[model samples]
Target: MPRPKSPRTRPTWRRRFALALKIFVGLGVLALIGLVIAVYVARAQLPSFDELKSSPNGQMIRVHAADGTVIVSLGPSYGEWLSFDQIPTVMRDAMVAVEDRRFRSHIGIDPIGLARSAKLAIERRGEGRRLQGASTITQQVARTIFLSNKYDVGRKAREAILALAMERKFSKDQILELYLNKVYFGGGAYGIDAASRRFFGHGAEALSLSEAAVVAGLVKAPSRYSPTADAEAAVGRAGVVIRLMQETGKITAAQAAAANPTGVALAPAPRQNSVRYFTDWALPQLETLIDETTRPLDVWTTLDLNMQRAADAAVRANAPKNAQGALVTIDRDGAIRAMVGGTDYVSSNYNRATQAVRQPGSAWKLFVYLAALEAGHKVEDKVVDAPITINGWSPRNASGANRGEMTLRTAFAYSVNTVAARLGQEVGFGTVADMARRFGITTPVDTRPAMVLGTSDVRLLDMTRAFASVANQGVAIIPYGITKVTAQGETIYAQAVDRSQVLVAPYVAQQMTDLLQTAVNTGTGRAAQIGRPVAGKTGTTSSNKDGWFVGFSSGLTTGVWMGRDDAKVVPGLQGGTAPARAFATFMKTAVANRPVEEFDTKVTLPEWALEPDEESYFGQPDNGVYVDADGNPIDQPAPPAEDSTDDGDRVAPPAPVPQSEQNPEQLDQDWIDRVLDRTPAPAPRPTPTPRPAAMSAPPRVPEQPSDRVLIRPQEARPTQ
Candidate 1:
């Protein structure tokens, strides 16, 4: 009752309360001023007007063929510029409806829209619903042109301030034009004009309602909404845009229902040229050519368009779905004229021609045969084509039948496994490996007997280059792709003139070429023969996993391989079938206009090896013969058992009998067979004297004078 009677009695407290309220209000006003000042200062540090106007148009690479024709364009391709009035009204309405429904009535910022968006975001979070964004058209223009796309409070504050500045400087139409002109629309398109041309192949002014909706939907995620990248996603996004347009009254419900995403027309994508394989190979070379640059690059290459077309057609027609074919054509000077890496580059960009490391199979016999010739083995030397095993592994002939007592030339033509293996042991394995490396084969070689039959893995590129050496008359040549690269109309790099060194002796190369010619003419590679003289080899792996034909005309070296990426066997396919046919198809077109040339067949055998002597063969023809360092025929021995048939169809030789029961001649013959079989020679025992009943026994063979010799003659003694 006392307080109610005199409320005014607390005047001092009332005055103090009033003064505190005024001070609080003053601090709030000062804080607001500081915030405004901070926002303006941050805006000043953003991208300058000149920097925004001079943004880089993405880099482009233009690859040209050897004939100076533009084969293809790589990288982002931007179209002509578009103006605000040139943009279709439907496109504008579509963007406005999807991006900002209240775009026309709002200022640079919309507090009500922000509040509504925030409330919905909170409700969605609690209800597990998708959130909605509240960026205005002005704000998007500001961010795309002058701000980073970060989403923290500082970025939001700066975005708001810059949007206000943009609104104050330009009208709504100008802000919209800026946004439409600078926003990305996927496939490296940066503006509405480029997007329209890339997607519709027309100007922006010609966009239809459905097309406009598609363009509008791409604003969310250009790559995801790009029709080329994902047509289904793009169509779904366009339907969403159409629904939003209907809800916003930009289009009637009937119109929205009538706009079918499937009915939307899109331009055909540009044809992807097979030459991309060459560009992929040549792109890395650009870094070495130009250290670094922002300018457009023009690369001049050695690719012949006609040859590329021929190679592509050949592979497409010949290669199976599960299998792929790779073809590389290199000139004698080492310039790559054509290269087809795979069947379809779009489906798979793997470059089989350059990157696949496959077992060369018998194609690798080129190196083996070359090594033998260099080590003093003649093409006409005799070798038995009987079944033979080395170190517990017996390699069977592909034909499943062996020819008996054939010359080395016949053995090579038939791809005889036993003869090749026997020859590998005669010529040191180390020598074969060295010869392969000397010819530019970087693959590691194992000296095991299986390696001689082509177990080592080698890249098709390396093999092609090695064969190019044979075509170049023993000069080793390194394959090259790009000729030169220019940047901004100035030459940045030019390839150096190729310098080749002799790796194989001319005589040896000629002999090898002769061997290969026989292979193509009458051997397993008969399918690879062209109208012009061709010399090459055919190779098939153990399980038919890889089929290959690597051959050369006098002017070009071409290699073709057919196989699965997973190393699975192609059913019933062999090197003489798909691979050889593809090579012939490509080469026939490849050398149409070139002059016909033959391989240089001149070769001279060492004087001592020119003729065969009585010592070359044993008394019987069924036994194997021997050759010395100078390729002279050394000696041969008769079969172990007197009943042993002269035919080469005999089984594995019986193990050596005990020396004590045999005459000196039988002991000598047994030791010689062990050496030929690569079995360890028996330990020396006291010589046995023959009885008068076995006077046919010959002189005892002596030990090899040097370990390097595969066979050495016995020392002669004067007869009593």
Candidate 2:
């Protein structure tokens, strides 16, 4: 076998070169065939030219204030559809320089740029950096319109194919226009005009060089480079863009120096982004009111920008540190004028005004009192404030001391828990719950005696609506924000004129208003007083967890709530302290120019309520006389020893006397006769003394000088 070795021969250089060339050619041919197959697949999947060109831009919802001031734009906001000529030259040049310097010279994809990006990517890979992108503007347009942004090889191949197709079908100007109009800028902005408006409060045609640079810089990282998000970062990015513009000869060195981003003025968006809360609340209603939201629609909201500004200022200034606050303002017609969901929308977007459900505390008493009035109980009707136990649950006043007896008005104004509990029990908690539902409290109201003290939770908006019902003279109100929705200057939907539905009688509303007015005048809501007849109530939850003030004046209703987000106690918090003061602060400016209007003064009183009864006489105990259901003291023997047990710490409830036995009409006649000296009147009860210190009226708030004034204290109210 060894002897059979073949002769060794080396091929000439030409033969070896030919063999290498053949192998290279075969590989090239195979690559070309694979590329052809991929292109065919991608092309087959491509949309028609018309379909791609006519693709809709992002759905923009321009929310405007009642005065037509743009508050916010929800979804992906698009500005006016602009042609290439309408776009500013500086903006176009900046985009080209920063995004793709070879955009005009490239045929869909730039080989030079791709090779450079690959080199950089390879260099950065060792440093664990993100890969560089070399997508031309044409590629970006194609990706934005026809292909997904996934970073897979297949997606990139499709993107390249689409970009090539777009280049062939459209002019360079058209491609640029599409890119400028469809690019996603941070802050929910799409299109050059939208980005310009969002960042500079003007159209793209009005963008200055610096502003244009800022917009163009957002192409790399919209959120991180957004001027609204971080001005310094945006300015630095813009400086880079300016440098690129100068190097690309789109701008001169002097122009680049002059295009200082530091001097750029951004649009006047709220620093806290407070208006976003309102827009979030309103945007959902658009679907119900209109057929679809696929187009750019103009929403004429009921929000008053001035009021919104004031509300934001007040909440930010007054909300306690480490605590949150919410405020909502509505006109008499139920139009929500201002809403601050939390102290700052940036920190947390949980809408406390419309979404949070917390105990309303004594504010829930509004429904109980309204129920009593509807049940023929008068504000001046006497009710006992003695210690009471319903189902083993003992409710105590905020003061923790029982005020023996007082008029219904005084009890309500003072927020006497014992009196409210007794009234709820007598009037029936079912009726109280129904009354709350009538006033638009959508939250579940427990039909239990404890609910009379506001153990059930409710939203600030629901409580505000309940008060608005009373302010509307018993008419139920549905809070609304959108007044009209239009598209392309044609009205798509208008808020229909809803017929007013009376939830309570006019007289009942009037009577409830009187009680509320007294509460503001001297009771727990005194801090909420605005000089020209305001009516409202205050609510404080257990351990001072939640404080609330809901009031209405001058055809406007406003609600304020302060609390911790975790339902934990904010030590020393109270309804009249921070919440009431905030209400007054917001309302002072809220109703500054509105004409002073007084609540309806005509309230019909019950016959028995005309004369003062023992309980109504300065909240003093009765003179050993057992009162019947009519509150008229009857001549009866003293209660038995067992009835007076427990060391007299708890007063025995009045013995239930038959209503037929005590004729209220006859008693009224007898009172009239006694006044006329026709019959001997019972010896008048000894003049009752002033209320106890714990139950005494609050000190009068000093009067301010104006037709419509808020008597704000020089210093903030003490907590609790």
Candidate 3:
């Protein structure tokens, strides 16, 4: 009874087989219907064949130096388009051997190749091997031209459909031509012709067998195998391609051996790839200047290859090994002539000249002094360079001890911090910030009192542009690199000469220039002096984290910055030492052929500005003794004594000024001695005074030129 019941419930084996067959058939029909819908959808979304063929390949920006030398080619660069016949036979064979040996036999998709690739992938699973791709040359053409790089079932199906459609519409030769013209090779090169020129410096038709293998190897991973990126890796990859050529019977063993991938000669790279920094800075400007970027365009820039080479050499030679350096040189009209963002462009592409924001230190004083001049303060006006505390923040000069009283010119030349802080207060912080903005400082300016010493961060480019405004005789300058942009032999954009509005009065700029000129000639920036007239400011931040020298000479303004990327202190680093020296070395060569042009000298200087700063010449008048212009000690008349009081209400006599401290003038002399290669005689120091119990010590002075000096009668200079 149990056996009979089971048979009745389970039904016969034939009946069971028929039911399973029906279900399988139903599922197969559903799958076929879904595939049909997907094909229809994909076809609807695809572009017309003509539209795909006529579309621009990609955007390319070819930047040229002022002399028409190619500085850099950005984005996808395409060389002359080559027809199938124009391509070399070896190149065509190598590509086929490496990418798809069955390219000619497959009907857009190769089932056998896909099955082999799938089996290899399954065998290599968990072995840390890269998954194999089964894309044929036709499939690659379809994906590259008409589809995205998304790796998914939907994308694969669409790619397959597109490849089939292309095979139906175009001849095999036509498909190969499209594939060769649209594939991407590294270093921004597009198309076989471009790839050939990029790697071998020759057209596709002129490609050698080894070079052909090298170019063909780039098809798998362009960046990894790019000859310019890693020549050895590229050569090794080419060797693999050569082996494939031999295995596929595309070349005989002797032919492969003679190919000698290792002997392939790559094109020489640009003398200094650091030019990329300049091009990177200029590329963004194109977005705003032009309306379309789909077509290839030629950008004529203001960069001078000679100046750029000099700048690169100077930075490399002068920058400390433990730190980085950046330099920006612009014409008086704000044309960027040379830009070196770092010592090595390959290691890091961060454009410090245009992108990094760091404290400029004393260099920020340019704005403070300019505001004072515009506020009707004369360079001859006396300002006290003594200890000052504002809102609990005490600022000290580079010298620990203050030089009691000095002219504004003396304070500026010496870069006395106390004087700058007092001036910032007297002129109003808001006004100082406004002056900086007016002079083209685009970064935010802190209105705090300490900002007078350049606490706010700023870019080297902005600071250079601000100084260029002064060198341009108070005319505002907007730093620019591109001079013109052309596409298809037609001008798309051209720079206009529009630096008309003045940032400061000509007279104010003249006075500021006088101070800056003195700074370079005898002050903190003494190391930056070139034989010709030069005006510049040196900046060294706290802990020597950053050093900067920004100057202008012979109608060129250049700014140099040195520091570690991490903003860590570099021992013995000062703006006057490395940055200023770099500035001088670069300028000497940058302006060697240009005529020497002096700064404007229409504004007359005050008598004090022309005369020697006595406080600087002698140690700050110590105790009751003062030094004469002749450098002899002279006693001053004593003041009347105050009445004695036991209640502690009487004022205490001012503490005796320290005699061991070197004045600004003495610092200047020391710097001059170094520059002139003169060993200076050490000055005698007086006995140290006992410190008062309640008096706090001054901040330690940084090693720098902290004193001013007299412009010798023979070297008397007019206001510039």
Question: Which model scores highest in TM-score?
Answer: 2
Q: Each model's TM-score, in the order given?
A: 0.63, 0.69, 0.68
Could you tell me the TM-score of candidate 1?
0.63
Off by over 4 Å in 1: 1-50, 53-133, 141-150, 162-178, 181-194, 201-210, 220-263, 268-325, 331-352, 372-427, 480-497, 505-515, 543-545, 563-572, 592-720
lDDT (CA) for every model shown? 0.71, 0.75, 0.76
- Greater-lDDT candidate between 1 and 3: 3
Give the lDDT of residue 149 in candidate 3: 84
**Model 2 per-residue lDDT tens digits across residues 183-292:** 88888887888888878878888888988899999989999998888999999999999999999999899898777799998778746578888988998887688895
Candidate 2 wrong stretches, greater than 4 Å? 1-59, 74-79, 97-136, 184-189, 198-201, 210-270, 284-299, 313-324, 344-348, 380-407, 416-419, 485-493, 522-524, 541-546, 563-574, 602-720
Weakest 10 consecutive residues of candidate 1 by summed lDDT = 711-720
Candidate 1 vs candidate 3: which has greater TM-score? 3
Candidate 3 matches the true fold with a TM-score of: 0.68
Q: Between 2 and 3, whose lDDT is larger?
A: 3
Q: Residues 606-694, candidate 3: write the lDDT tens digits.
A: 22221122222211211122323222234642232321111001112223336675343333435654663554445333222333332
Q: Which stretch of 10 consecutive residues in model 2 shows the poorest summed lDDT?
A: 642-651
